[model samples]
Target: MTENPYLSVFTLTKYIKRKFEADPYLRNVFVKGELSNVKIHPSGHIYFTLKDDKSRIQSAMFRSAANSLKFKPEEGMNVLITGDVNVFESSGQYQLYVQSMQPDGVGALYLAFEQLKKALAKEGLFDERWKQRLPSLPRRIGVITAQSGAAIRDICSTIQRRYPLAEICLFPAIVQGPQAAPSIVKAISSAESYGSVDVLIIGRGGGSIEDLWAFNEEIVARAIFSCRIPIISAVGHETDTTIADFVADMRAPTPTAAAELAVPSREELFERILDRKRSIYRSFSHQIKHERKRLTTTQQSYPLQFPERLYRPFTEKMANLDDRLLRNKNDITANRKHNHERLDRMLSYYSPLQRIKEESRNMDLLVERMTRSIQSDMCKNQDNFNSIIRMLRALNPLDVMERGFSIVYKEGNVVNSVNSLKVGSTVQVRLPDGTVEADIKSIKMKDKEEDSNEQ
Candidate 1:
């Protein structure tokens, strides 16, 4: 058999890929389509289908090209793509390897600006709460802009004219093109790290958006936001707005206006000082007049005109009290004298010797009567004592004991009944002359019927 002439699948695909690469028209192509089935891979590659009307083509943007894109691509978005058509060798399919992409009807930069504005706003970067208050009088003003531009000149001149006392420190930076954002950020950092400037004025003269894009950069915006010193943004004209403006502490329409905002006016300060001085002088004069009126009123008052009148009433009251005291003393003396004379006369009426003699006679009579009465009472008492002694002798227990009767004691107490004596207990028997100790051998109690019959 003859050798097979058919090409293998890999050989055919390789041939097609070479053909697509060789065609100059396919090498650089521009296509407009609506995105579909868009997917962004974790590796930063974008894969999608580009469709318009009835036709669709597979497309891809590798990480290198995707990184250059300013706005994100989404499904159903109308976009213009620029890339080369090539075969995906493994799949044997031709696809557009996108190099650049932009929204179909908008400038890429403007769209990027709007998209960034929305994102940062949603993150609260544009909130009023994050804005710092500008100093009323900044001592050192730092300026960040082109080294040799109308912006620097205008700002320096305006500051010098308005507030000569403020020291201007120029931080020269590039304010245009791609390098401007990094330059502005570096200048802001230098000013912050320097730690001496009270306020910063970052701005440039009026320009197109393309010329002023550095101020809109996210890095520059964040730098302004993170600065410790207060920042005032002045870019382009009155109508221009950028991310830096939104994040700065304040915004000015022009560089000159930024300078004017940074420091106070010397003339206005002088006027205020003069006004305060005048107010102080007027207040002092009014106070002096008020004090003089008070002094005059005091000098013309009744107490000052006739000073003795103030103490007259007190003096009269003192005199009256003294007179009452003297009268009370004299009256007390007369009463004391009268009492003394009466006591003396009564004492004279009873002489000590006569009183003693009379008392002695009365005492003798009383003694004699007491002696007779005591003797008569003693005789009567002697007769009554003899009768009681005889009666006691008849009733005495000892007398009865002498007559052949005895007393029995148990535990030192007299025993009156046989029931009080236990058979094993010891007791004492008392006679007229002696006590005899004995143990009870037995006890006998009288029968209740016999005792009752005897009673």
Candidate 2:
């Protein structure tokens, strides 16, 4: 039998892989294409096909290179890929091993920023409602920035100039370069752990977007959002905006501006205090003038000037009532006397004596009956006079006062209810003996339920 002349499939694939590796053009090639058939493996490797209108190439990005990518690689995305063309032994096919990948026509960092901004926005991190409010007067201000940078100096100086009482606590962090994001996040955590800072200022001086990219990082943004203390973001100049700014309680145009926002101006506060004092003085002065005028008017009034005249009318009315009662009593007594005399005259006219002469034995009985009748009429008239006198006494106000009851007067008006008077009210108590001035120390109104139950 003759030996096979053809090479095995494995041997052929190995030779092709060696050829692809040795080629200088394929070793470091840059290709631009649309991504397709993208799949991320559990092992952290990414497999995809890079395609154009007419051609397609299978590609693989190992974990090491894929980890460096700023933005996620998605299917159908147009990308610029840099890697070596290599052959896969198992598949017996050539593929590109991606060293790095980026979205074509845009900077990697900018694309990453946009993609993160969109994602975080969807999660509501950038919503205005999530932002904290800055304290009006911060006793202690925390600053997170590079210790040696102009940002820290500006913040400290501005705060000191505006509000000398505010204490400045610096959380020195790397504000630029690769380690900046984690450094800022660590500083934020440290501030939280300290827990005494009223406001936190996180920022750097003006710089390029690349120089200020740390503040745009998601970790830093999240740290600022989760911080209990209010945060003021002041990264770069007025034009520069970062994700931290959106998530922060407030955004300042500069580091100095952030410090100003953190603490109130001493001069402005003094002015406010002065204004308040002046307003209070004016109010008190006006109130005093009004009270004095009222006092003067009350002192000169007719009631106070001639105090005795106030009760003269009541005294006269009482005298008239007494006179009318006396006249009524005299008239009632005279009417009763006249009626008795008329009854006597009628008895005499009946001439019972003449009838007695006719019957001497009936004379004693008639005389006894007439005496009883005259006694009965006198007794009835006396009883009626006593009843009238008793009724007159019962209707007298003095009689009611004599029974240990008193009339309550407030401001010359009768106090019929506790609701009409309050605590500290002046009142007059008219008793049987005399009128006593009193003040209401306290008043408690009876509840509806209690009144109903009592009734």
Q: What is the C-alpha lDDT of each candidate?
A: 0.92, 0.91
Q: Model 1: which ten-residue window has the lowest total lDDT?
A: 415-424
> Per-prediction count of colliding residue pairs?
0, 0
lDDT of 1 by residue, 1-104 (tens): 99999999999999999999899999999999999999999999999999999999999999999998878787898999999999999998899999999999
For model 2, residues 1-455, the per-residue Cα lDDT tens digits are 99999998899899889988888999999999999999999999999999999999999999999888877788788999899998989888899999999898888888888888998899998888887888888899999999897888898888889999999999999998999999999999999899789999999999888899998888998898888999999999999989888889899999999988899999999998999999999999999999999999999999999999999999999999999999999999999999999999988987888766778868778999999999999999999999999999999978999988999999899989998988888999999999999988988778999989999
Error of 2 at 107 (Å): 0.8
lDDT of candidate 1 at residue 181, scale 0 to 100: 92
Give all candidate RMSDs, comma-separated. Answer: 9.2, 36.8
Error of 1 at 25 (Å): 3.3
Provide the global lDDT of candidate 1 against the true structure.
Answer: 0.92
Q: Provide the global lDDT of candidate 2 against the true structure.
A: 0.91
